[model samples]
Target: MPQTPLLSVVVAVYNGELFLAKFFACLEAQAIEGMEVIMVNDGSTDGSMAIIDAWRDRFPGMLVIEQENQGVSVARNTGLAVATGQYLSFPDIDDDFKPGMYRRLLDLALASNLDVVTCNGNYVYENNRKPSRPIFPEDKLQSTGVMSGPAWLKKALDSRKFLHVTWLNLYRHDFIREHGFKFEPGLRHQDIPWTTEVLLAAQRVQYTNERFYDYYIHSASVSHKPDTDDTLIRSARHYIKILEMLEAINQRYPEQVKNIPACNWQIAKEGLGILHTFNNMKDPQKKKMIVKEFFDRGIWRLIWKNARGFRLRWRLGRRYLKLKKATRVPG
Candidate 1:
């Protein structure tokens, strides 16, 4: 058995052969000391397993867990169960981490004794070097500072850029372990709820302006394609659950949580988008089932309850009209 590592980077691999080499190259170049890579293979049927095997040969200490096609959430939880590190982070297989990112983040976290250390990331599009908007808005976090959990939560809720992502932060393993922070299994929108809960539980959170991670945006990603029935329904259901989570957090820490209405409005817009996707589907059976599901679960009622903004209300009204037309059975 090898000595313990300072940080454990958990990766969920599923048919990621195309980008495995690049990701491994970046990982091999990290200057961090005593770091271990814990990768969970979610039953990748492609050459992903082969690539992982090659890397395992090269790095004898790398921990790899194999499981049937459960989901990314289960893969991550599987990793968390056995990770033997002081700190933890989860990076996607397709993204790039700038050299020394782990080292820098670790330095910050250790120096400040923070529960979490977060940095900025660049959203790299295939055709463009720069995104239209910055991932971390200039005004959101003015400088390197330490903030209370409540302060961070309020700011994160106000600005879309404030909460960069789960992967952009370094979390103490003990902090997560104490709170029992596990990603919601079988849900694609696991990051939002899990991150929100972690921040709520954290006492001190540190932020830095260094852009150390690259988030590659592709057309094939789930967030970019919600047209299909399964994707649309899953995303909509997750959004409702996320809203409920935020509401619960707000109630638990009423004085700390601000802009609940704004957060609700943003999530409600996505809910409307899901309904629109269902409305545009051509398959009548799946469409009818989804429509029935939406009504049966009172999704529309929850959406209407939170549609406060004028633009959101307008969009919700339009989507509801289309849903009504789509749900009407021919006599």
Candidate 2:
């Protein structure tokens, strides 16, 4: 039997031919032994498979899964099911990371027996039009210490800059499996709730100041695309689900009192985001439908109940009044 690899990198590829070569090149540069790369090709019509095939020989532990195009959430969940490593990472195919990134994270995880280890990264814009920006400020991570996951989450949320992206961190396989944490299939922004749950459940989490990952921002990215009526509706629904998930988590772990306010804040943010999306929608009929749906689902009450701080509550109230008057929807 083969020894278990130290880490597993699960990437969901869908029409990512353009970036596969460079992504593979970055992985090769890592030079980390006993690292398994699981590539789930979600029915890519492009030459993505060809590029993956060309690089198959580079990693002895590489595994490839081919499946129908079922969206990224399903693709990632598929890869997560079969991963056989002590640690796990989910990275985008179109992104690259600095050399020695995983090695350092793995070493830290091993040394401290951490449930989750996260590091900083840069947001690299396409065409170099905008300069890269560090995901976290150096001052925020200067302590470089291990703390409870909820504690770390509280600090991060207080900073108001915590990102929910999965790729910035490495998680213990057992911790993930023990919780049966799987990305919701067909749900956009699944990372928000997933990350929140993981952090809340993690007993030992650490952060490093090392800027390792490069999250490339380009016009072609799914997030950058202009929101259509369908996409907006989906996004609104997704945020509503996130708010509900946070409430459930808060109730499930009542001892995590310090974490509850932050969680509620997250709920408020998502609620406001939904309201903003609804307000910006171009179609009046669609807007009316979304407003009615939000009220019917009691999302406004969720925001009002969970929203922290006087200013935030005031903003929510003001926005609700404006939206209610504009749409003539019930208070």
- Considering every candidate listed, which one attains the maximal TM-score? 2
TM-score of each: 0.86, 0.96
Q: Residue 289: error of model 2 in Å?
A: 0.3
Q: Quote the RMSD, in angstroms, for model 2.
A: 1.9
lDDT of 1 by residue, 1-331 (tens): 8777888989999999989999998888885667788999999999998898888865658898889999899999999999988889999988889999999888888888889988887778867755534568777755458887656766766665555267898899998998888988887777877776687778989877788888888765657754676666566667767666655655675554443455565457657666766766777766767777777777787778767878878878877776777678553
Q: Rate the local accuracy (lDDT) of all candidates.
A: 0.77, 0.88
lDDT of 2: 0.88
Using lDDT, give the best candidate's number.
2
Per residue, candidate 2 scores C-alpha lDDT tens digits across 123-226 of: 89999999999888776654459899889888888788889889989999999999999997887788888888898899999998889999999987988999
Error of 2 at 211 (Å): 0.2
